[model samples]
Target chain A: MEKKRLYWRICCVAAIILSIITFTPLVIPQGVSKPELGGVPYSLWTSFVITVLLVILTYIGTRVHPGMQNEEEDL
Target chain B: MIFWVWVFGLIYAGLLVFASLRSYKKNRSSEEFMMAGSNIGLTLGVLTFAAALFSTFTFLGMPDFFRINGVAAWIFLAVSDGAMVFLLLWFGYHIRMKVKGMEFRGVAGLISRCYENRLAGYVFFLSSFLFLIPYVGIQIQGIAIFMDAAFPGSFPAWGWSAGIVLIMLIYSEIGGLKAIIFSDAIQGLLLLGVIWIIGWACLSHFGGIGPMFDKIGTVQEDLLSSPGPQGLLTPQFLFASLIAILMIPVTQPQFTTRIVVMKSMKTMQLMAVSLGAFAILVILPTIFIGMYGADLYSEYGRDEFFANAFLYDQPDAVAALAIIGLIAAGLSTTNAQIFALGSELRGLLRGNENSIMTKTKIGIFVFSVIAFFFSIIVIDQLVLLARVSFAGTGIMGPMIILGILSNRKVSPAIIYLSLTGLIIFLLSLGGWIPDMYFDIRLDLILFITLGIAAVISHLTGTKRQLIRPKTKE
Candidate 1:
C-alpha cells in the first residue's frame, strides 16, 4: 500500500514536471512563436495530438483498478 | 442558420426535462434522491465530478481567458487537478469515514459537527448561501446570453432564462442529485463532443495550428507566454491561485456531496484521477480554440473576443457547434449550483428528510426565479458577473482552512484571524491597502493568515477532540 501510494505520488509529480516543461516555451513571452515540430511549429497540431493522448490515457487509467468492485456481492 | 440552433437548443432542453422527470420517479426516498443511496460507482462519480467541474465557466470563460490572458489560464487545470487528487487521497477519504452513514445536511452541518461548533457551521452556511445564489444567477445569465446569441429573435433573453430555470427546476426537484448526476453525464458527453468538433473545425479553418501560431508569432509573441498581458500575476500569485483552485472542491458544498455519494475510497480515488484527466481533455481544447479564435479575430477587444469571433465570422456549422457547447456548459453548471443551493438551504432550515426534500424543490424554484431575474439585469457582462461570483467565493477559502484546522482543536481565534486575513486580501484587491507592503499579493495574505492561525492554534493547545466511534443506526 505504501509503495503504491509513493508510486502514484511520483507519477503525479512527473506529470506536473512534464506539464511544466511542455508549458515552458509558451511561457517565455517572446510573442506567440510558431511551435516547431521537426521544423514546423506544431502549435495546434501538437496540442490536438497531445489532447488525444491525454484523453486516451485518462480512459485507460479510469478502467484500471486494484480491487474496484464486485457486482455480485453488491447485488 | 439561427433556425438550426433553435432546434438543437429546444431538443436539448426537452431531453433534460425528460431525464429529470425520469429520475424523479426513481427517487423513492430522501437518501436515494439526495445522495444516490451512497452507492454511486466509479463511472458515475467520475462523470459527475468532471461534468460539475467543467461547467459554463470553463466552456465560455476558459477560451475567453486564453484569448485575453494566453497560456497562463491552462495552469489552472494542473493546479485544480492536483488539488482534486490530494483531496481524494487525504481529506476526502477521512471525511467520508467520519460522516459515513450520516447524510451531509450541508457543508455547514458537516463542519459544525466536525468541530463541535454550531456557530461556525452557521457562518459557513450563511456565506455559502449568500454567494451561491449570485453564482447560480450568473449561470442563468450565461444560458440566456448563449440563447440570445444562438437563436437571436426566436426567444427573448428573459424567456430563455425562464425556460432554462424551469427545466433545471423540473429535474432538480424531481430526481434531486440522481437527476442532476445522470443529466450531467449526458451533458458532459455532449460538451466533450462539442469541444472536439470546435477544436477540429478551428484547426481546419486555420489550415492547422502551425500556420495559426505562425500568424500569432508575427502579431504577438507574449500571447503564448505565461503571464501574458497582465504583469499582475507573478509566480507567487500563480502558487496562491493554484492553492485557491485546490480549495474550491473542498469548500464547495456541491462537490463535497459528490464525495459523500461515492461507494468506497477506491472509487473516490478513481473518480478524482479520472475527473482530472477528463478535465484536461475536455477543457484544454476550449482554451486552444480560444487561442485560435484570438489569432483569427485580432481586431476585437479582449472581453468580447471569444463570443464575437465565434459568432460573427465563423462558418454556420462552427458557430452552431460553439453555441451548443456553450449552452451545455452553462446548463450543466447552473443545474448543479441550483441543486447545491437548494440542499444547503434545506439543511439550514433544519427540516426533516421529507420536508427537506420538499424545501429543496421549492428552493430550486426560488433560486431559478431569482437567477432568471438577475440574468435580465446583468445580461450585458456575463463574464464580469462570473468573475465577481468567483471573488465572492474567494472569501470562503481562509474560512474553510480555519474550519479544517479547528477540527483538530485549533483555536476558534483562528476563525477571526482568517476572517481578518480575507478582509485584508479583498481590500488589497480594491487598492485600499498600499502596494508598498513588500508587494504582498492577496494569496500571500491568505497564506500568512493561515500560518499565523495555525501557530496560534498550536500555542493555545486547542487541538480537536477525538470522537468516539458511534454505531450506525
Candidate 2:
C-alpha cells in the first residue's frame, strides 16, 4: 500500500514536470529552431518519449497488486 | 468509385448490426444492456475507450491542425493524452473502489450520493449535456462537411448529419453499451489501419519523412517550430489544455462508465497504458498527412484541403475505404457520447427501472436530434471546437474528485464553487467575460480556485474523517 502511494505521487509529479517543460519556456523556447530527431522536432519527440516512459513506470506500479499480476485472462 | 464506397459502407454497417444483435441476445436484462454486465474484458475495453477518445478529430481535424499549427500540435495532443492515461491509473483506481462501495449507476449518481444531494448529479449532468451535445455534433458535422464536399450537392450537410445520427440511434437502442463497444472495436481497427495507409501514401508522395519535413521547412519555416504560423499552441494554451483533457476520464460519463465496467482494475490499468500507446500510434500519422496538406494545399480552404488530401490524392480504392473509415470514426464517437448521456439520464431519473429504461431510450433519440441540429451550424476547425467541449466539461473535475475521493460528506460549497467556475469559464469563452484572471487562463484560474475551495471546505467541515480505501470482502 505504501509503495502504491509512492508510485502514485511519482506519477503525479511526473505529469506536472512534463507539463512544465513542454508547455512552458523552461526547456523548449517558443518560435525558435527546434532540433530535428527522426524527421520530427526534438521537442515533440521528447514529449512523446516522456509520455511512453511514464506510462511504463505506471504499468510497473500496477504490478504491486496481486490480482493484477495473476489475472492474465485475455479478452 | 462510388460503387465501391457504397459496398464498403454497406458491409461495415451489416457487420455492426450483426455484432449488436449478438450482444442483444446476451443483454436480456436492463443492467446487462446498460452496463455490459459490469465485467467487460481488457481487449473490448481498450478498443472502445480508444475508439471513443479519438475519432474524426484524429482522422481529419488533427491533420488540419498540423497543417496550420505546425509540430507543436503533436506535443499539445500527445502529452495531454499521456497525462490522461496516467490519470486513468490514479483516478480509475479510486473511482472503482468508490463504485464498489456504493449503489451508484453513473458518475452523476455516485457524485450526487457523495455530496448527499441530488443537485450535484443534475449539475454534473447539465455540464456534460451542455458541452457534449456540441462535441458530438462536431463529430457528425466534421463528416457531414466532408460528405458534402465529396459528393458535392448530392445531399445537404444537414441531411448527412441526420442520416448518421439515425444510424447511431438504431444500433445503440438495439443492443446498448455492449453493442456500442463491439462496433467500437471494429471502428477502432479500421480507423488505425486506414489512417496509417493514407499517412504512408502521403509520406511516400514526399519521398520520405526527412525530405517531407525538409520540404515543409522550405515552404513554411515557422511551421517547423513552436507557436506555428497561427500562434494558437501557446504555452498557456497548452498547459490549460493539459488540465482540461486530463480531466476527461473523471468528468466524461462515457469514459467513467467504461472504467467502472471493465472486468477488473487490472484490465482498466492495462487499458490505460494501451490507450496511451494507441493514441501515439493513431495521432503520429496525422502529422504526416497534415504535412502533405501544408506542402500542396496550404492555400486551399479547409473543406477543399480535406477533400483533396483525403479523397482526391488517394487511389479510388483507398479513398473508398477511407470514406467508410471516416463514417466509422464519426459514428463510433457520436454513439458513445449520445449513449452515455442516456446512461447518465438513467442514473439520475426518478422512476421504476422499467420506466427509466423507456425514458432513457426516448432521451437518447432527443439528444441525437439536438446533436444533428447542432451539427448544421458548427463551422469547420474540428479539433479546436472539440477542445472547447473538453474544456467546458472539465470545469467539473474538482467537484467530482472531491465527491469520489473524500470519506466525509463533502461540504456543499464544493458544488457551488464548481458551478460558479463552470459559468465563468463559459462566459469567458463566449467573450462576455475576460479570458484571463491576473494574466492566467480563466479555466486554469477556476481549477485552482475550485481546488482551494475544496481544501478549505474539507478542512473546516471535517476534523478526522479518514478516506480509507475499501477492501474487498
Candidate 3:
C-alpha cells in the first residue's frame, strides 16, 4: 500500500510537471508553429501530446491512489 | 430538412419524456429527487459530467473560437480539460471521503458544514448564481439563434428560448435529478455522434489533416501558431484558463454534486479517466471543424459561420441531426446548471422535507425563469462568456477546497476573503476596475492570493479532527 502511495505521488508530480511544461516557451513559444509532426502545428501537436500524457497519468492515478485502498473502511 | 427535423426532433422529445417517466416516483424522498439517491454508476456519471462540461460552448463556440483565434485555442480548452480530469481524480476522492457518512447537499451546504458558517454557504451559492445563470442563458440563446437559422421565420428567438425553458422545467419537475442524468446520457451520446459526423465531413473537405493545415497555412499563416491572428491565447490567458477550468469540480456545484453522488471511489476515479478520454474525443473534432471554418468561412461573422458550416454546408439529413444535436447539447447543460442552483437553494433552506422540496421546486422554477430572461437579453461570444463563468465560480475554489480537505477548524477569514474576491472579480467584469494588476490578470491574482490565504488559514487554525463515522454507503 505504501508503494502504491509513492507511485501515486510520482504520477501526481509528473502530471504537474507536464502541465507546467505545457505553458512554457518550449511548447507555446510565441508566433512559432514550426517542427510540425505530420503537418500539425508545433504548439498544437506538443500540447496534444501533453494532453494525452496527462490523461495517461490520470489513469495510472486511479489504480495507485492510496485512498482507494481504504474504501472498505472509509467509503 | 424539415422532414428530418420533425423525425429527429420527435425522437429526441420522445426519449426525454421516456427518461422523465422512468425516473418519476410517487413517494420519492427529497434525497432521492434532489440527489439522484447518490448511486450514479460509471457510465452515467461520466456522461452527465461530460454533457454538462461540453455544451453549445463546444458544439458551436469552439469552431468559432478556432476560426477567430488559432491552433493555440486547443490549449485554451482541451489541454485545460486534460489537466482538469487529473485534478478531478484527487479532488473527487477527498470530497467523496468528506461526504461519506453525511447527507450530501450541494457544495453550498457541504462547505457551510465544513466551515460551520452559513455565510460560507451563501457566498458559494451567490457565486454560482451570478455566473452559471448567464452562462446557461447564453447557451439557450445560442440554441435559439441556431433554430432561427434553421427555420427562417417559424418562431422568434425568444419563442424558442421559452419553449426550451418549458421543456426543461417539465421534465425536471417530473423526474428530478435522475431524469436529468438520463437525459444527459442521451444527449452525451447524441453530441458525440453529431460532432464526429460533422467533423468528418469537414475534414473530408481538405482530403486529410496535412492538406487541411496546408490550405489553412495559405489563407492565414498566423493561425498555425500561438496567439493567432488576434493574439488572445497567450500563455498567461491559457494558464489562467487552466486554473479556472481545473477548479470546476471543486467549486462548481453541479460538478461537485456529480462527484459526491458517484456510487463508489472506484467508479468516480474511473469516471475521471473516462471523462478525460471523452474530452479529447469531443474536442479533437472541433479543431477539424474549426480549421475547416478557418479555411472556408474565414471572413464571416459568428452567426453566418455557424449557419453555413453546421447547416447549409451539410446535407439535409446531417443538418437536421446537427439541429437536434445542438438542442441536446444546450438542454443538458441548461437543466444541469439551473437544477444545481435549486439544489444549492435547497441546501440553504431550513424546514421539513416536504416543505423544503416544495420550496426547492419553486426555487428551480424561479432560477429557470431568470435564466430564460438572461437568454433573451444576453448576447456574447459563447466560448469567452463560458470562460468568464468558469473563472467567476472558480473564485470560490480555495475556500471550498480548504473547507473540504482541511481536518483543522480553519479560520473563516478565507471565506470572507473569497466573498470579497468574488466582488472584486465582478467589479472587474463590470469594467468598474481594471482586470490587470502589474501585468498579471486579476482573476489569476485573486486565485493565487486566496489559495495562499487558504494555506495560511489551515496552518494557523485549531485542529479538531473528529472520529470518522462508520461507512454508510
Interface RMSD of each: 6.1, 3.3, 2.2
Model 2 Cα lDDT, one tens digit per residue, B108-155: 888877888988999999999999999898889888888887788899
- Rank order by lDDT, top first? 3, 2, 1
Order of the predicted models by TM-score, top scorer first: 3, 2, 1
- The per-candidate count of clashes, in order, stands at 15, 0, 0
Q: Which ten residues in a row have the lowest lDDT in candidate 1 chain B?
A: B379-388
Scored by lDDT, model 3 comes in at 0.94
True contacts kept of 3: 0.75
lDDT (tens digit, per residue) of candidate 1 on B74-102: 55444445444544544565566567556
The weakest ten consecutive residues by lDDT in model 3 chain B span: B464-473
lDDT of each: 0.63, 0.84, 0.94
Best candidate (score: DockQ): 3
Model 2 TM-score, 2 decimals: 0.95
Please tell me which model should have the higher TM-score, number 1 or number 2. Answer: 2
Reference-based lDDT, residue B110, model 1: 69
Docking outcome class, model 1: incorrect
Reference-based TM-score of each model: 0.83, 0.95, 0.99
State the lDDT of candidate 2 residue by residue for A26-71, as single tens digits.
Answer: 4347876467787766666667787687567557646654334444
